[model samples]
Structure formats: C-alpha cells, structure tokens
Target: MIVRTIRVRTIWSVCVPLPLLSLMLVVFGLTTGEFVIAGILPDVAAGLAVPVPAAGRLVTAYALGMIVGGPVVTALTARLPRRPLVTGLVAVSVLANLGSAVAPGYGLLLAARFAAGLVVATFFAVAIATAVSTAPEGRQASAVAKVALGMNLGIVLGTPLGTLVGQHLGWRAAFAAVAALTAAGLLMVLRFVPASPAPTGSMRGELRVFKGRDVQLALALTAVGNVGVVTVFSYIAPLLTGVGGFGEGAVPALLLLYGAGAVAGNFLGGRLADRALMPSLAGLLAVLAAVLVLFWAAGGVRILAVPLVFVLGLLAFAIIPGMQTRVLTAAGAAPTLAVAVNASGFQTAAAFAGWLGGAVIDHGPGLRSLYLVGAALTAAGLGIALYVLRRDRRPSPEPGRRPEHAGT
Candidate 1:
C-alpha cells in the first residue's frame, strides 16, 4: 500500500519532505494574497481614489473569481499531469499579482485581483492531492495538515509582514512582493515537486457525491457557519482605526496578535475535532456568537479591544478543523472535488463578508454595527448546525486527522 517514503510527523513537526515544503511555500503566497488585502484596504482605497467601503469590494471580486474558477479550472485540467498543472497555476498567480502592482486604475486593479484569485483554490486542491498521493500509507492526514500549516503561517506571518510592506511602501509594492514570493515558489516547485499521473476520477462520479444530504449540510455549514468571522475580519482595519482609535500604523501589530491567536487555536482545534466533531463545532459556534457580541459591546475600549482581537481570532480559527472534518468525512470519495466545493464555499462566505460589511458601514448603523451583524449571522449558522446535529443518525466521518483549512 506504500506510495513512496514520505513521512509527515504531526501538526507540530518541523521536518517535511521537500515537495511538501515547496507546496507549503506556494500556499503561503496564495493565502497571503487573499489575506493582505484586508490589512491594506484603507491604503488601496486612498491610492486608487475610492471609498474604503468600495476598496472592500476588491476582496469580494477576488473571492468571486475563486468561487467561479476552482471548479472550472479543476474540471478543465483534471486529466493533466499534476506537477505541471500546479506550476502553471502558480505562474498565473504571479502574472496576475504583477498586473495588480502595475495597474494604474481601480477597475484594472480589481481585475488583477480577480485574476490572482482564480488560481488559489485550484492550486490548493491539487497541492493537497499531490501531498496525499506522495505520502506513505496511513499518513494522508499528516500530509494535509502540513499543507494547512502553510495557511496558518500565512495568517500569522504573511498578513502582518505584507501589511507592513503595504504600510511603509506603496500598496502596489505589496502585490509586487507577493508576486516575487510566488515566483520563488514556482522555481522550488519545478525543482522539488515530483511528477504524478493525472487524476483518474471522472467529473460524473465527483458530482454524484454532492447529491448526498450529508454533503449538502456540510457545504451549507461551510458557507454559513463561517460568515460571521469573515464579516468582522473583512473590515477589521477600519474598525480598529475608527473605533479603537489606532492609527493605520497599528493595524499590522494588531493583526500580528490575531495571527498569534490563530496559531494557538489551530492546534487546539485539531485536537478537539479529533475527539468529538459535531459537539465541538456546536460549542465553538456558541462561543463564537458570544465573542462577536462582546466585540460589538466593547470594541471601542482600547484596552478591551486589544485582547478581544486575540480572542476573536482564537474562536474563529478554532471552528475550522471541525468543519473541514465534516466535509472530508461526507465526501471523502471525491476528495479533490469535495475540497474544491468546500474551498469555493469558504470563499463564498468571504465574498458575502465584503458585501455585508460594506453594506453595514455605508447604509446601516455604522462600523461598530458590523460586530452585531456578525453575531446575528453566526447565530443563524449555529441554529443550522444544531439542526444538522440533532437529525444525525450515523457516525461522524473520521478523516484520520484534522484536515485544516486552506480557505481561511
């Protein structure tokens, strides 16, 4: 049953095979592209002569591209060699980010952002599959976790550092740097990522998995269950600046704190999900709703707001492992397509987050109202989660290890 000799120790292991390490770096670049925009929204708005709320739509556009692009790209390229397809996707991202850096107008920059996002989910699906295919028997979970660590690192390191670049330099420079990162990743992929046979599964069989009710619930939970956190995070820059009275300079530091919380949460979440998937999700969502409420009430106080940012990060990331476990368990038969669907659903929530946060800021109560809005949305998701839990009649799917998210 052995595919090769690759070994991924655990969630905390540092030593990984070069191919997986290369894929990790590539994912870091992709996730940073998704996350850094949040930190630089105010700067991008000013640079492009648009409103901050309007700048938020750049995020929506990128997410919409991912939603549309993942399935189409995967379907079109399913039978192609894995290594070259992965490389081509990263190459596309590099070009798109370069376009973002040089575009003179807001419209063109938005287009560039969308193009950059198109390759993200497809890369993740292929990259994870590549990691799995190359792993020793009984270690697919470790392989998935290793790639997911790239995403966590993107949140913890990439966003804060990228924010610093955008803050000190021009926002355009930030995109350029991401392009450079991916360019480096492309070279490493060429050197390290081994060639693999094209996927043999048909699109018909993959589509068939979605007809299951369990799969349907899992996808809905992914889109709905996570929207609240995504909402607050989308406008986090303005909230901290306007409400917490921090200067734009302070946003990176706060995001760093949030990132630190996310790292801690990622490990804690995996352990919990491995033990009791549904119960843990229900508990995490309930706490997430409470945390959002707390954020709404105390967001203005500088002292409280600081710690609350960390807590919000903790609770938000904590729910991801359980949700991912749900999807992998429900549709493990077509993991690549299953992962693609879940990734799109994850981006769908992010897209909604940009729209809903902008709507709240522009027309509703105000920036602070975003927290309450998030709380309500999370409560709705929690209700949906509880209904799914109550109607359960079978064992929760055990996907060996916690399949940490690439979409966060």
Candidate 2:
C-alpha cells in the first residue's frame, strides 16, 4: 500500500495548485471574451446582421464593465471572505458566458459580455490580493506567479481555444465553451481553495495607499504597460496574416509558442524579483521596449515571426510578477484594495488600447501602426520606472521622510 499512498501524495501536490489554476482559468475566460472579436468578429457580425465595426463595440462594453467593477467591488466587499467572494464572482462569470451563448440578439450578447467583464474585474482583484496575503513573505513572488499564470494562460490558450471552438462550433459555441470552463473552474475553486480571512479595514483606510507617490507611479506603470501591450496584441492575427503572410491555421501555433515562452519568463521574473525587485523591473521594461521595436521590424517576415513572438511574450509577461510585488510593497499592510485597483487600472488600459487599435484600423493607418504606438507607450513606462529608481536612490528630505513607508 506504500505505492498507493505515494500516488495519493502526488495527486495532492497537483490538486493543491488547482485553486490557483482555477483563478487563472477565470482570467482565461475574461481574456477570451475580450479577444473573441479577433476570431469571431466576422461571424458575430454575420450572425447579428450588423456591421463588423459595430460588433466590435461589444469588446468596448466588456472592458468598461471590468474597469468599473474592479475597484467598486473590491471596495464594497472589503470585509467579505475572499474565497467565497471569488467563487461567487466566477459563478457570475459563468452565467454571463452562458447568457452570451444563448442570447437571441446582438444587444443581448453585448450585455452578457459586459456582465462577464464585471465578474472578471472583481474576481481578478480578490484572487490576487488573497493569494498574496496567504503566501509566505519571501515566497510572495512565487505565490503571485501562480495566480499571474492566469494572464499567461489567457494569452496562450484563451484566443486560440476560443477561435477553435468558434470555428468548429459556432460563434455562440465560443461563449458556451467559456461557460463550461467557468463552471469547471468555479467547482475547483470551491473544492480546493481554503477559506480566506476577512480583512479589518474601512474603505478610507484602504484608499490611503493612493496618497503615496510610489503607489501612484506603480498604477500608472501598470496602466501604461497594459495599454501598450494590448494595443499591438489586439491585432496579432491581422499582423501575422497581413504583414507576416502567415496562414490562418498558423496563428494559433505562433500564439502557443508565445505562451510557452511567457510561462518560462514568468518563472524567471518571479525568481529575479525575489532576488532584486526594482532592477529586475527596470531591465524587464527595457527588454519590453526593445521587443516591440524588433516586432515592428520583423512584422513581415514569417520565418522570424516565431522567435520574435517568443521574445515579445517573454518580455511583456516577465514584468507582471515584479509589478505586483512592487505594488504590494508600496501599498503597505493592506494590499487587497491596492491589488484590486491595480487590476482596474490594467483593464482601463486595455479599454484604451482596444479603442486606439480600432481607431487606427478605421482611420486607414493599418495594423502596423499599432506596433509603433505600443513601442512608444513601452518607452514611456520605461521612463517612469527609471525616474522612480532615480528618486529611490536619493536621500530622504527630512528625518521623517526616510522612504520607510514606500511599498511596491
């Protein structure tokens, strides 16, 4: 029976990580919904009998829901047990996807997407905060990495999987698949995650973190970074086909390679952040800027697309854990609200990027300009990081001003 016991132990090891993975799946659902337009825009337009551009507005509505829900729900549920709150949010997400799958008209599907985005916002905020709070201090990066894997998972799997489902099934089938995944994820969250202790704080107390410059800078950095990345990434399929001359079938393979690279970068990023948080961040942003420029140059070469996509994925995602660490560090003791707000900022940035990308596509500049825009935004974020680093290097102004309260 020793062999049987060992197998059980191995299974537990795998199961222990399920709660974290479940959160990522929730993220995957959100990301998939956000990106569904990429593959299903035509189908949705055809189905709804609306213009493709009008169908794209569904993405906008979804992002708006996420942006609005993140901080509002975090603030409202500050005292709720995170596990239950998160599980409930996932349930909402499942319902939203189900609604999208069954909706009779374009307007109803649009509304459903917005509702799903709302749950996405709240779930992301609570999950990240609780994961960080429960983690052992030194292992915070690893803990955060577990959850951040959701972003990578969403990036790697969400689009391709959603597209595949849409292709084999129907556009509505895409939402049906998302709904099924959400149900599975919610069940896992309920079964595997331990109860989260409620925080003892007023909304005012949690809001105090915003008064700190470092916190503000960190939020700005997140917003800028996300906007930059999504601006270009929102049109990735188009870029591959229009510029890279890749066939439709080849896009998913390229995305999968990028996802694999992101997973590797995420581990390295977490480790390096644990070792040297700030410098690792600086180097990462630098790499991000470089990668965007390289992407622009190689946008047309199918042969070079693989390595460039890998590098782009790596540099873009590697910054996530460190950024989370930075924010938590700056937010002082109560990190839940800060984490939630960070998510809000990220979603807002996503909304901005989507709108910007759509505008570029509409105004006749073509998809290639997205890379230029993304590169510029990355450079701006890098500049912000460098400024923070420079200021951190200086001595405190007063005996009281000694940077002790600085968090992220």
Candidate 3:
C-alpha cells in the first residue's frame, strides 16, 4: 500500500494539468497554421495563380490582424468567463482555417488568413494568463514556457511536416489538417478547461498598466526584438535557397535543426527568467544580436549556415519567456490586459518585419540584407534593455502616487 501510494503521488506530480495541456494543443495548432504558410508559400502562390511575392502578403495580413485583435478582443471580452472565451476563439480558428482550405481566390484566402490571425493573439494572451495564474507558486515562468513549448514544437515538427504534406498533397490539404487539429483542440478545451472568474477591474483600471514606464519599456523591447527576429525569419525559405545555396530537399532538414534549437531555448529561457528576469532578458537580446551578425557573415557557407541557423533559432526564442515575465511582473494590477497588449506588440513587429522583408526582396539589396536589418533592430532592442536596467535601479515612487502620463 505504501509503495503504491508513493507511485501514484509521483505520477500526479509529473502529470501536467489538463487545462494546460489543452492550451498547449491550441497553441500548437495555431502556430502550425501560421508558420506553414512560410514553408509552402511557393505552392500556395502557384495554386492561387499569384506571384510568390504577392502570396507572401498573406503573412502580413495575418500579422496585421493579430496586432489589431489582441487588445481589441481582450478589452471587449474582459468580463467574460475564461473557458468560454478561449473555446470560442478556438472555434473561430477552426472556421478560419476551413475557409482557407476552400477559398477559391487570393482575395478570399487573404481574408481567411486575416481572420485566423485575429483570434490567435487573443487566444495566446488568455492562455498564457490562465497558465501563469493557475501555476504552482514559484513555477509561473516554467508553466508559461511549457505552453510555449507547443509553439516551438509546431515550428520544429509541424512546419516541416506541413510543408511536406503541401508539397505532395497540396496547400489546401495542409490548411484542412490545421482545421481538423483546431477542432480537436476546441473539444479538449470544452471538456477539460475549468471556468475562470473574470478579473475584477473596470476598463479604466485595466488600462492603468499602460501608465507604467516599466510596462511600456517591456512592450517596446518585445516589438523591437521581434522585428529583428522576424526580419530574417519571414524570408527564411528564400534566404536558405537563394543565399545559403541549399537545395529544396535540404530545407526541411535545416528547419529541423532550427526547430530543435528553439525547443531547447524555450525551456532554458523559462528557467532563467524564473531565477533572474531582467538580466536574463538583457543577455538573451545581446546574444540574439550577436547571432544575427554571425548569420549574415556565414550565410554563404552551408557548413557554417547550418549550425548558425540553429543557434539563431535558440537565441531568438530565448527572449520570449523573459519578455513575457517582465511584462506580467511590471503590470501588477492588470496582468491580463498587459499580456494581451504585449502579444499585440509582437504581432505589430511581425507585420512591420514582413513588410520590410518584402521591400528588401523587391527593391533593396535583396534576401541577404535581411540579416543586416535584423541585426540593427536587435542592437536597438539591446540598447532599450540596457536603459530599462538602469531605470530599474532608481528608487521607487511613493506608494500612493501614480504617474501623470501613461499611454503606449
């Protein structure tokens, strides 16, 4: 009896909460759908009778919707129950993906992609908030990271698989598969995710998070750093083929390496953030900048590009947990809204980066210059991080005093 009890306790300790597992599946499905477009852009363009550059705009449209949707949806549904809100969001995702699978024209497909993006940021914000709030004490960052692992895996495992499926079966089939996965995720959420009480705060009160300088700094860091990462990542397929001299058959293997690095970075960042948030963030940004420079210099050589791509993936994602933790910590009174806004910041950066990459490919120095652009943006982010660190060293304001100005 004693041995059995110990074994049961150990199993319980190792088992993840059902709600978290559900959220991870939702994130995985969403991320896979989002990134699969990048991998299969050529096929999609050919199928839709559009140029590849034009099809790339689909990514920008989706990102723009996320930038708008995160804060808008969060604010609008601030008083709703958590389970229903998340479930409904996932349901929307299923429909949007299905629409993508069947859309007959580029315009219709673009609309579907935009709709898909709209729900993703809102879902991610709610899921992260739910995961962190329900986590065991002192394990919040780890819990958040675990949910994010789904995204890392989606990149590592899903994108390559989806690309292969698209290559063999068709891009529409890939979107159909995502729709099916999201439908399954919706069922899991409905069955396992418990209802969470709405946070007690007026819209005005929730908006107070924007008043804090720390929160602003954190959001800015997210935006600029993501710009750096996405600038290169948005054009990765072409970069590998055109600049790295990689064949189409080799792209999936290289992506696998990058994805593996992302998985490692996700957990490592979570652990470091849990221990020391600010320092870890600053270090991650610095490493990211350095890695971007390295990628630019070595991209021409396949041998060097292979390992550098992996390291680049690692350093880029390592900033996420730290950034999320910093935003939540700084937004003491309005974590939910703050997290939503932070998600918006990331999407906004993604939109900008996508546009910038397209411009570079069309008119500027072309694909290889993406690395230089990424490095510059990352270096700027590092400067902001240093400023934040210095600002943190100053004495705190009086307990009852609120700052006079606060708006992002």
**How do the residues 283-358 of candidate 1 rate in per-residue lDDT, one tens digit apiece?**
8899989988988888888899999999888888877766766777777676666677689889877877888899
- Compared with the true structure, the alpha-carbon lDDT of candidate 2 equals 0.79
Residue-level lDDT of model 3, residues 281-351, one tens digit each, is 88888888888888888899999999898888888778898888778888887787788889988877877
Stretch of 10 with least lDDT, candidate 3: 399-408
* Per-residue lDDT value at 169 in model 1: 94
Better of 1 and 2 by lDDT: 1
Runs of candidate 2 with Cα error greater than 4 angstroms are 1-16, 245-249, 298-302, 355-372, 395-408
Q: Give the alpha-carbon lDDT of every model.
A: 0.82, 0.79, 0.85
Please give the lDDT score at residue 192 for candidate 1.
81
Per-residue accuracy of model 2 over 245-278 as CA lDDT, tens digit each: 9999998788888789898888778888888877
Q: What residue pairs are clashing in model 2?
A: 326-408, 329-407, 329-408, 330-407, 330-408
TM-score of each: 0.79, 0.86, 0.87
RMSD of candidate 3 to true structure, Å = 3.6
Q: Which residue pairs show backbone clashes in model 3?
A: none
* Best candidate (score: TM-score): 3
